[model samples]
Target: MNQPVSAVAGIGPRNEEVLATMGIYTVGDLLTYFPFRYENHEIQPLSEAEHQQRVTVQGTIHSMPELKFFKGKKSRLTIRILADGLLVKVVFFNQPYMKKQLILNDTVIISGTFDRHRLQITGAIVKPVEKIERGGLEPVYSIKGDLKQHQFRRFVEQVTDGFIHDIEEVLPESLMSRYQLMERKQAVYYLHFPKDEQAFNQARRRMAYEELLLFQLKMQWFRKNERQAGDGQSKSWDAEAVNAFIKRLPFELTTAQEQVLSDILSDLSSIERMNRLLQGDVGSGKTVVAAIAFYANFLAGFQGALMVPTEILAEQHAASLRELFAELKVNIAHLSGSSKVKEKREVLEMLASGEVDLIIGTHALIQEGVNFSNLGLVITDEQHRFGVAQRRTLKQKGLRPDVLFMTATPIPRTLAISAFGDMDVSTIDQLPAGRKPIKTHWGKRNMLQRVLAFVDKEIEKGHQVYVITPLIEESEALEVQNAIELHRTLTEALPHRRCGLMHGRLQHQEKEQAMADFQSNAIQLLVSTTVVEVGVNVPNATVMVIYDADRFGLAQLHQLRGRVGRGADQSHCILLADPKTEVGKERMSIMTETTDGFELSQRDLEMRGPGEFFGVRQSGMPKFKVADLLEDYRILETARNDAAKIIQSGALFEHDSYRSLLMMLESDIAFQEEKVD
Candidate 1:
């Protein structure tokens, strides 16, 4: 099964190159390249066909096929066929050679769109009566350049017929019997060429289960290895002191916050290193929880590190933490890329000298010169914004310090399991007290004047406004407002109000200044792109106007809406979009209906599959051949449980039943690389 494409009979050197372009280098790759969809080619009478519907009909040719040339190399072949006592005109383009094969009075099978008004059938494929595989489903693959579906299908058949037995089973026989799954070899063959619907369904289920189960096993193994890496620091802190600190806070902790804090405290006290993900919606008091955790770590004589994505956010966190820890007399320091050389050196000296009990910074925390004197915990805010390498580097600064990841993005349970299954997840589903839900409304282009009037009114009330656009500059392809143009227009519309423009194209310092100006209320309106989608808190910013809101996903829109409604006063989010599709319209409607980020995330996952839900690159999710994270969520849960049981039994490597699975895991390049990392 690992043989190259050149080893196949029909695939030559040219075809081998073509297959390589499609990422099919080996016989195994070709076999696992499953079809995206299937076409039912069961013979149906023309009388049962509907207009513009794809149908397969068998007919006798009533007239000679006429071939005509047009526009240089282009050609068209037209023929009339009689089926079910009806004469239908069949047309094929760019395939004039069909004139010779389509004989008169001969029965042929035609499959394409049926046009009832014109009594015509635009045939995409036609085969002779004897050559047609009647009453069977035809596999339709996504092909690349110079690769025809029939040719690829022939190659797959050759490999399946010749080497199906070589496909080893990854799951044990016990699992197969328990799940009523078919043999791996039989499933692979049936997936390529199924005899019936039942066979296809069974084949799909078996393959999907295998993929999901293998993924879960790898995740479980990684988690086990992580737990056994080294003994974690059994840090101890006075519970009464922590309670006193929590009581000293200006605001009370929500029940959800308290539960999550308890979970974190339990992990911190354990010998096993804590690798946890703390996720919640925007303005859910996550920062306060992190502050409390840092305080406890300080009580244990261990330093804590907080990493954020942006300098402004780091500064904001530093300021908030300083105020929270004022009464405790804990030494806190701030660092960033923009810090002066002398200032950075002093901060580094303090961090390495055990003077700074807690440090908050941007990517500068992971730089080479940064060192910690007994770093006990590492917390990264907006965790997804940082790459895996960055996170790993920071964690390595200490001797296996406990790592905590915080994100304002509320990931659905399915995604959380699939992406971060190795780590424990604690979610803060509740917001702080007295927080009001932001009022959302969809606005059309014609309502721009009214929206601007509302923005003016908000500014008059001493409240700031955020005007968001999808692009930084005018895009020729997209007919939506850009940051520059929107800034100009807003400045012109409100001459008395100060407006600031911010986008990704700006320098770090420039962006920082923009955010500072906005936070300081020096800018009454800020016209920006999605750069403001993350952690930028300003209580005075009460109105968020997003133009072309449909261009963003539901989760993103929810995040942007969260920018407002951070204060006790009622806030509003106006979605100015005229989406053309029903899905886009539904997204706007969903935004207006609820403010729950998790609910929107689930709906977003349902609308866009998992691959596109979090963006495949940033998601760090494995690409599955047959398993779907959303559609096969139940199978995923089952696989996770079974994998956990196998691992907990402590016989994975010792049991002969798991030998094949172990070999497969070893061969997985991504899994091996992760193990090394």
Candidate 2:
């Protein structure tokens, strides 16, 4: 398993590079590159084939396959076959060699979608009965680069053939026995080359459960150890003073906010250092909550530091924090990597002198030159945006300062417990008053013209629009919509309106400038990616058209929708998705049904799963190879229960029985490097 993938049979340097693009570098990686779906190749007579289904059909060549190429189109191989006394047409794109393999009266089996357009099959896998070596379920790996499905399956089979036994059993015998799970070697063997559907399912269960259990154990262990020796100072609070400060806020607090504030204040006064997450939907009053905590820390003679993921957000937070603490005469400074030399130096100097009562900044706050006299409170805006390593670095600035994490990403309670097992959580389920529900609609990409027309109409009304694409630019390996192309398309289609583009690939100043232009109504339309998923708030923008919405997770789609509806004006979130799969269509339907983010989050967890729910583009989230928080909820919960007991007894890692499991978790890059308390 430790052997490089290049060491496997038929894998040269070029092949290694292709596989590497798919996350397969070592033989171990190849072994664990699980298939996302499978295809059954048991051929059926043409008469028995279901229309539009992925069906395999065998028949004799009824007509010659003529090679044809359009002037500006791809070459195609078109032919006809007679099966079960019925004629079916088949077409293959840019595959002229298929004609040589399939000739008149030659029996062939073609596996592909049975297109009813002309009673034909498009993009087929052709195989002569004599050349058929492997049959039954064939794994379709999640592949990238130029690796074809069959090629990847062959590589996995080759890797598994002579080295599956190298996969040592990490789970204890007692646990495996209790769960009736297959051994590590056996599970992997059947996973790649499953004997039957039932066996494949059993193999999947074992691997998924094992992965979830290992992660749960790691997180649970960290939670217990941190709480025991966690850093935080015990503070004495003046309730009368705290209540008076709350009374002075511009708006009254929601009941939910009041409850969360009480909980946070209690944690501040506790002996243990606070590590808590504050969950609220967008427009929820989380800012005031953070302000109250900082005030308490400031009254206790300690400086507060707030870290945001983006510079714009940092500046926004600094401005708001200054306004909130103005009555108390608290000094505030904003520091960021993009800050000018003079500004940065001045802020650092003030921080070191304790002249700044509170400092709000991006990662610049964690730099070596920025030192705090008494950093007693650490607050991270959009906590998920920062790496665990980065967040941990901030803690070093203070002696276990009270930590509060603010997030607009609404996660289901089940996920919050597992993902943030190390920290306590408080949720503000209510949104502020006058928050209007955004109207959502779903349509296919064929409706792009209508969507564009609507954008034009909205612009004429003096309202701005946001156009989102899943990708920043075209990728050879992916076919999702890209922002740059969409921006150009919009500019040409609208002709008169000013259109702008923003994505993660742009320079920081470019992104900031684009967002600023959009906010000022200088740009009628802004095409972007999920980089605008959080942070940018433009109440003037009332319409959002998300291209390829089916490609995004439900939680992410919800976040994008939240960008609009920030203003009192009627807002619309139009999802342009032509999903071919049932799951994708279901997601679009759900989006149009309700605007409840938490409901969408739970459904997202159930449909797209944790890793995907968190998203492939998002950072600082734990990745799991097998365990899915959605499909494996039962097993995940069971694993969590066991992990709790194991941690409570304090024998999960140190005990001889779990040594191998601990070793596996420690070596896994999926779980972030756990820093010992």
Candidate 3:
């Protein structure tokens, strides 16, 4: 089945090399490289154009465009094209080669967006009238390396032209009719060369549905297999022991926390393996809930592991837990990368000897040579920090300890279903006692002094402040805020104010020292990066100023705001940005209007679609190709149903046709489990 690369129509040897460089080799790869977007070739009349405007116009070339090079440094080509008796100016930059492509009197389709001066046709495609008819949307795919769109599209069409013929419907007929989905071949054709908006929409729906369905099926299968292989965990504990531990805390548990703890306790008592996700917003007391579960397992005389993402967070959790358990005289230890060799060996020895009731740390907990004595529960903070493999390894440690995963990032229902369908979910939406909402404001760079003054006011009140910058060290482009330089400037500008700096670049101990100083009120203000986005709780911090706020997404801005407003004192989050673009204004708008993280997350999904924003991928959740955990939620739901049906049917386990797919998934799950451990 060695096929010539040229079989994919537009790919000559030179173009093939370009595609190969981009990791595209076979015809299948060319066809599967779906379009990132579409260029509407539905030509618009230029006669409707306004003066000093760039517009799309469908017309024949009235005359051959003149080509002239300027001083040998640049070349310019201009032409007069007529559309319904209206003349439009077509200009090209350094495009003398385009003169040969634009034939005289050719009814070419020109398409480009406009600014207020000239008709820009960066994506002008000529159509020889004698070859075919026109008037449809053009598919524009993401090209790799040096591959031209024109060549890529031509090759895609050729490959798709052949592949579509052999494409059999993977979805069952019963499911297809139930969901009103088009046949696979028709969907592919319409997606590549849609005849109308309706056709495009329908095709996209089908494709999205199929992708989501596959994902849902996989998750549901995992859930079913997990449930069916039950009754391995037999340990159970007295509820009073957990209750006694809770009664010892300084602050009373919120009703929501109690309810979630009840759910956790119930899950842990079950013989079936526990796979639960506890979704809580920042400062919603997920830690207390996790602590209760850990204590419950300890009361049952089994060990527990609480894994956090950072050494700082790990140390914080271990310290807080140790203090809390000291009331009941329980033993606790922490193991992180920074732990000394003697200390690490001691912790490992205690764990193996069943002397330590609970162990808390970062990835060091997953490192080799660390053994747990009767490990009964595994809790992961900010679930995204650890992959599935990490969680699995911890669970596999003690005959599959009950797993409790917690996240402060509130995910949409659709996103949760897609990403965490295999695990049962418990949400803690209520804030704890005396927590106040952070007041949000949108300002520009010109209002810097006012924000600085406000920071001074908060400091004067004996409250600490946080000034967040998008960059940690320094960047050549974004000059408005740099934590390192700002720390120095603030130290000099406000001599009375004790300022400290914390960023990702600093050593672990340096960060810990800075944060500790800020917590002790030694630093009146802390200038830092987003390293403090999660798990850093400072009740005294009353003001947060984010520079170049436009650079951060709505959800992230919400998360940073969550860093504040934790105490009884009223807090403010000032969003400062130079509104030079429409996107900047939109981001500022989102910050002012919403205090809800979920709402902000939805808005973020809408504004940015899906791409990287402020270093966190637009999703900020997890990575998935061919599946959008947010936009394709409906498809996920449908896929879940399909997966349930397939598992119930029991045909897949026997069918050799799907044996390879099953093996691949199982192998991946095993590998993931190993990696996480």
The candidate maximizing TM-score is 1
Q: Compose the digit string of candidate 1's lDDT tens values, residues 528-601.
A: 99988887889999999999999999989998998999887889999999999999999999999999988999
Estimate candidate 2's alpha-carbon lDDT, on a 0 to 1 scale. Answer: 0.83
Stronger candidate by lDDT (1 vs 3):
1
The regions of model 1 sitting more than 4 angstroms off are 47-52, 66-77, 93-101, 115-119, 673-677
List the pairs of residues colliding in candidate 3. 52-116, 53-116, 213-639, 389-672, 389-676, 390-676
Report the lDDT tens digits of candidate 3 across residue range 1-677: 13656676557788888778766777655655577677665655665655544344567787788989888769878776666675656667787888987877777655544433554443344555442332356677767677677667767776776776766566656667888988877887787778889987888788777766655656776776666556447567787776777777889988888888888888877777788889887788999888888878888888999888887788778877877777675798999999999999999999999998899988788877988778888898887766666666666667678888898877767666756777789988888787788889988878887788888888988899999998877777766688888888778878899899999989888999999998889988999999888888888998999988888777677888888898899999999888788988988987888787777766776676544422342223334434565666667776777777777787557666555445545654432332211
Q: Residue 284 of candidate 2: its Cα lDDT?
A: 80
Q: Which stretches in model 2 have alpha-carbon errors above 4 Å?
A: 5-7, 12-21, 43-52, 57-95, 99-124, 128-135, 143-152, 310-312, 337-344, 413-418, 433-593, 600-618, 669-672, 675-677
Pairs of residues at least 3 apart in sequence or in different chains that clash in candidate 2: 232-273
Which pairs in model 1 have colliding backbones?
Answer: none
Q: After superposition, how far is residue 623 of candidate 2 from its true place, in Å?
A: 3.6
User: In terms of TM-score, how similar is model 3 to the real structure?
Assistant: 0.88
Q: 587, model 3: CA deviation in Å?
A: 2.4
TM-score of 1: 0.95
lDDT scores of the candidates, listed in order: 0.89, 0.83, 0.75
lDDT of model 3, residue 325: 78
